[model samples]
Target: MLKGKLKLPDRLGNLVVDFEDRDDKIGGSSSVLASSEELEIILPNGLGFSRHKDDGDGLCCTEEKKTNEAAIFRASARPYKDRAGSVSAMAFIAADEKRSDFEYQSELKKNTEEELSSSKQNVDGDSDGLLRRHEISSEDHPLSLGKASVWNQYFQHMDIIEQIDRDLKRTHPEMEFFSGDTSFSRKNREAMKNILLLFAKLNPAIRYVQGMHEVLAPIYYVFCTDIDEKNVANAEADSFSCFVKLLSDSVDHFCQQLDNSSGGILSTLSRMSELLKANDEELWRHLELTSRVKAQYYAFRWITLFLTQEFNLQSVLRIWDSLLSNPFGIQEMLLRVCCAMLLCMRSKLLSGDFAANLKLLQNYPDVNIEQLLHVANDLSPDVSSYCPPL
Candidate 1:
């Protein structure tokens, strides 16, 4: 017989108890544990119980069995301390007549609690006393609780959350809204974090990435810096909606699964290369042959991050205006813009070798925005031309 005082911890409100029998050896003789005997527990009135089957390994309590032969009974208890610092016991007991195991186990838990209470009372009657009984239903249990805040659903993605926080802190360090320890900066960082979190939560596949904070910074900043002071306070909410809208069109590029589809990043790169070949065949061939610079090598970051990584804050914002305004969609216009960026540097790229050209494309030089957009608008893909692989 195992006998010892078991004090339940405060945090064990969702505790699950498992009962199993093992062979016992007395005086070098083995004896099998009998299933005929029933264990009894005397618990307080408020406690509740339910019968469930052991799913596997007899360790975890699974869903309640339908046949009513209770293979296992589990009791959940919530312990609370009163004003006088006296701890009260509340437990749940599972009862079913169809199964001897369930009936015996239910009785066992009830009797055990009652015996423990009696023993405690004998030791110190007035010191620690049981409080008024409040019934514990299945619905009241924490495990059976309803859905919490929508944000709570993403608790498993805490790593994503940490990454977002780190990225938010590092993004646009020069800007006061995202940089320092001021309340405004903290608010902006939080706004950015919330938007990214919601985006990941909604789209489980593409979820959050490192560079996304950069993409969202401008949107949130613009909303916060609105002319109307009232709009400033609601910047985060407005930014979230706008960011979702913006991401809807461009999210495909970020999805790795879609990278090789007809409309994936490869397709976009092909389109850009085709546009380049049509507009400036000499420049395209020179980069592809002599310079050995492929579109994916340089254009992957440019296209996926919405060119946010290639340019300064002011220039990116200007480019985004055109991107967001284009009814034909940003993908086509982005290809044109990328081509224009290359063409704008045609003079330098023509003279440079593979290394120099690759560096130039990776770290793009400044150009006249008005002229670049004009050149981009003028250029269009020759659909008839076969776009050979780079």
Candidate 2:
């Protein structure tokens, strides 16, 4: 159901999950094992490294440069919204920009949250402990003497809310030839609603944070848009499974306790800094020392939210195409994209003061999406075409 190939760690050995970590079944054969390579991301074309004429600097991401100068895009700031999820980016690519799946998922999530929130009047402190109450006290409501059965109440309301939602979504069936008010629509809504509700229920530690809709939206969109009729029909279940997998990889960024651990957000930020340093030390130093810009100041959202906020939805999807297929895994690919973002704005960043640079970085500028992604693709750690960012 996934439109893009699942980005897997290289050690996964052509497998999305680690192949070597297989359980010791009495015996298992290679033929019987499923192959995930079909889903392995392949660059659509022209994004590949091109051989350029020789200049003194050998083998790099150069494009017909007479002096073999490092490639760089002239960055310019026009406008941007903080993009929040790679999953959302991927969701946009399954079809045209206008009718992306991410939109559908987020809309559904919003509708669900509002429905659930408005139903219970006592959503005051907004704590998991508070929400765990199956029944609110009569004194809290002051009007109803009967107790509330949260489960029964939610289900009863879920049907009504979902029906309303299906009616709304059904109005626009022209998009991707999607059916309106059909069994599939009801089923899809129920599945997506359950996934969102269940995720909130299971992860009581963090509860349901905002922007999760960004993550779940695209998965459902991508699945429902799948060319296969059967896959389109099962979009909800497929989306639920993919959302779990995608969220699992990123949930640590949301957990407060794990903030300083080796696997936490801080560690990821450090790695991103190191990635930038390896690719362009001067830029790294200027941002870190000259500008004294903290990684967390700008990179926290970039890393955690996955650049959904950094660029237009279309641009993010273009980058995510490579990210989801990077073979090295999403984390590594993401850092490269972030670094490319910096390099794209090299001149401004180099000349700007701390405040200016910070402001610019925080509100990343728009650039040629193709060039930006190409620069990022050239920044791979293991295989460098010496395509140093100018």
Top candidate by TM-score: 1
Off by over 4 Å in 2: 1-193, 380-390
Worst 10 residues of 1 by lDDT: 13-22
Report the number of backbone clashes for model 2: 13
RMSD of 2: 49.7
Residue 387 miss distance in model 1 (angstroms): 17
Q: What does candidate 2's lDDT look like per residue over 1-390, in tens digits?
A: 121222222322222122233323435564243443222212344243344434874433343431221111111111222322212223333455557667888899999999878656456654432355566555445444333544554554465445444443542244332344577665655566677766766776764555554456556777877899999888777887877777677788888899998778998888878888888899989999988998999998887767866775556667777778877677777888888888999999999999998999899888898898789878848343123322
TM-score of each: 0.59, 0.50
lDDT of each: 0.71, 0.63
lDDT of 1 at 87: 30
